[model samples]
Target: MAPKRMPKVYLVRHGETEWTINGRHTGTTDLPLTANGEAIMLKLGDKAAGPGKLIDPTLIGTVMVSPRLRAKRTFELIFSHSPVKPPMTIDERVREWTYGDYEGFYKHEAVAARKAKGLPSGEGGWDIWVDGCEGGESAQEMTDRADEVVRTVRDAHRKWYEDPERKEGDKGGDVLIVSHGHFSRCFLARWLALPLPAGQLFVLDPGGVCVGQYYHDLGKTALGAMNLGLI
Candidate 1:
């Protein structure tokens, strides 16, 4: 039997949609991936999620996904390549940040609207990390949601490690989260106790993966790899 090892959490961003291709802010809109997007996801599965691939399905303990269609479908495509399906759940917290009034607007359009309203809007103006969406999630709200993700992952790891009966090759330590781009970046920021604005530094591509793990117990979380592209 293979020796037991620390579980690595896999963070996945869903593939492209029309809105994404058009640079629109997508939130609360359950849009399907483009045909090309779906094809690429199937490729991602074959490249990354198998017995000895980068993300071995058998090693994953839990799989959490956004309730949105895009994210859910991404989860399906990736795991479809592997038979060892882990326990999966739908979590609204992993959903994208609500754009509210800015929904469906491109970057330039949103900036223009903010400028017209006399709100900060321009280069380095009206940044989501600072001003947030006028009618949707605030930076603090994103922080709260990210914190919840961190807490959930940490608690799961804690339980897995504390179980006296846990043996080598058991699949209860690694985790997988299929979510949106911005929110997944925010989760990475919060996982390292960084400021929400720092999330901007970690831009995730669509149909990509980020991996993280704990070093000296659940208290110390570490980012192992990120932006491992699939498509």
Candidate 2:
């Protein structure tokens, strides 16, 4: 069998929304990006997805986007000027963590509400990775969803690398994922084969981008870059 080729994956968290600015647990909410958010994303797209940039447009094999409008719009802005626009796939696995009853509530508000109801808030407070949202997905569930995306993208990468009809100098194998914050983190954790809770340690700001790739020639998965912002 031939050796597997190392393929890079880029995770882009959608730009700012009204709920994001208000610190609300935005899950399954379809809100458009603010004007400022759109502007920043455009700039980031130019910087990261432009020619001779970190995410070379010509090298992108697949683009996976969350079904939410916010995520979809972010993808639009980021690739608006790309010379080579890869086909996009709307994957539910990349959707934001479903907040359930906690949806639209700020973290502190959710904590206080849970306290009022005498619900256990864990050691410190309402840590989603620990407590998850009431009536929502557990950490394991999130991990499962993220794993689905990872598997799909990895398969795509393998197919791209092993394509016998691939043209010379094509270099097309990278996968790009445009999704939500918590979901993106979960995707990264799943990509690295780490525990779901480990995703809590990392923060992906609105409009931020992270890179995951195999190091040492596909011997080990590695995080090449994270929390990269245009502004």
Best by lDDT: 1
Q: Ten-residue segment with the worst summed lDDT in candidate 1?
A: 1-10
Predictions: Cα RMSD each: 2.0, 2.4
Q: Please list the C-alpha lDDT of all candidates, in the order they appear.
A: 0.85, 0.84
**What digit string (tens of lDDT, one per residue) describes model 1 on residues 1-231?**
444566678999999899988889999999999998898889898888877778787777777899999999998887787866665689988999999989988877888888889997757556988888989999999999999988998787777767778665675577899999889989999998899999998978889899988776667889988878553
Q: Which one is best on TM-score? A: 1
Weakest 10 consecutive residues, lDDT, candidate 2?
1-10
Query: In candidate 2, residue 119 scores what lDDT?
Result: 90
TM-scores for all candidates: the values are: 0.93, 0.91
- 1-231, model 2: which lDDT tens digit per residue? 444457789899999999889888899878999998999899988887766787777788788888999998898888898886777789887899999888888888889988998999876768888787888888778888888888888787778767787545657788989999899888888788988888887789999999998777554778988878665
For model 1, what is the error of residue 181's alpha carbon versus the real structure, in angstroms, after optimal superposition?
Answer: 0.7
Backbone Cα, N, C clashes tallied per candidate:
0, 0
User: How well does model 1 score by local distance difference test?
Assistant: 0.85
User: Between which residue pairs do clashes occur in model 2?
Assistant: none
> Model 2 reaches what TM-score against the true structure?
0.91
